[model samples]
Target: MIVEGKVVKLGDKIDTDVIIPAKHLKYTDPSYLAQHVLEPLDPEFHKKAAEGVIIVAGRLFGTGSSREQAAIALKAAGVKAIIAESFARIFFRNAINNGLPVLACREVTAYVHDGDEVAVDLRSGEVLVKNRGVSIKCGRLPELILNILLRGGLVEYLKSAVN
Candidate 1:
């Protein structure tokens, strides 16, 4: 999917707690998770962060947590992809497993900023920086992850695996 939005910039080491506060975990449904996504960062985050907007963050984004709900929260909140300098392995895997597109870029955070409308090419792993005359390069996704994403997520892939 091609996403264009004003970035809601975040710093390094954004963890699951920041994505979805622990207080809301009582419910199993991911719908609640979306409500609390990034609530800690901005009480009105849900209202301000438009759906299909891209979340741009520094290193270690999605660190310090392994819960799948974290990815679900972002997805449900309409976050299309997370562009970060680095990400926690578990969270990265969780994102793709849940059909959430994530890309790793070391220099993206430096060139990107809040409220900057950028275009994300998920298939190409490139970000066309609007008016900056620059493009952020995100390395290619693994074949395994691509296959899962192409199938609409890991579960769907598994269902078709035996065919």
Candidate 2:
């Protein structure tokens, strides 16, 4: 499972509300949430990140109320992957549960830049570094979690395991 896209760098300590403001949670449909991803903070984000972008953020990312909608909105908004220094527990689970890859690494912020073209290979556990056409070695996830991602989230993982 390798997700590649243009990097979109966000600052530190961004919670769910900041990712998708709570005021817009009235609708239950994922599309509704997707349309307004970061709409409040940056109205043009959707336009720029139309084809799925790789979001890079600082530590303690996704810190806030446990709203799965936040993860849903990101997926719907076409954010194929997110690389953060760390993730709130619930948010981390929610992301993988929904089939969107959220990776935690100490130096992700250092390796990626806004608009850098990058690919995250969960199977290999490395965020393949691609910048100005240059490739570098960076954060690698655990093989255990990589297997979970390949199965497409925990629910699917469980189903396969049970079967």
Candidate 3:
């Protein structure tokens, strides 16, 4: 699968709390969580993300809390994908489990800037920065993970498998 969007740059160690603060975790509804996604880090994130953006962040992104809501909120807010230097293990799994494609490209942040148009090919793990004419390689997701994402998260994948 391929995901293309304008970039939304962020720094290191963005945790679950900042992604969707606990105060807003009252509901598991994605749309509701989207409204509060990154409210602590960027007050206008909801509006900016609604227009479809890809987040590119530094190492240890999603470093705190294992709440799956962070991934849900981001996906609902129209974040097509997230490219980070590295991710907290649980967050990475949670992202894929929620059908939020995340790529780990060590040099991605170097090539992408905020608002730059980029395209990500999940199968090839290539991150192309359109305006700059640069491509960064990230680890390709395994077929099983890809299948889960394609089916729209773990639960859906499981449901389909059983049927």
Model number with the top TM-score: 3
Q: What is the Cα-based TM-score of model 1?
A: 0.91
Which sections of candidate 2 miss by over 4 Å? 133-144, 158-163
Residue-wise C-alpha lDDT for candidate 3, range 80-104, written one tens digit per residue: 9999999999999999999999988
As a whole number from 0 to 100, the lDDT of residue 111 in candidate 1 is 92
What is the C-alpha local distance difference test score of each model? 0.82, 0.81, 0.91
Please identify which of the two predictions, 1 or 3, would achieve the higher lDDT against the true structure.
Answer: 3
lDDT string for model 2 (15-56, tens) is 888878878877758888887878768977776667879898
How many residue pairs of model 2 clash at the backbone? 0
After superposition of all CA atoms, the RMSD between model 2 and the true structure is 2.3
lDDT of 1 at 16: 89
- RMSD of every prediction: 1.7, 2.3, 1.1
Scored against the true structure, residue 21 in model 3 reaches a CA lDDT of: 84
Best-to-worst order by lDDT is 3, 1, 2
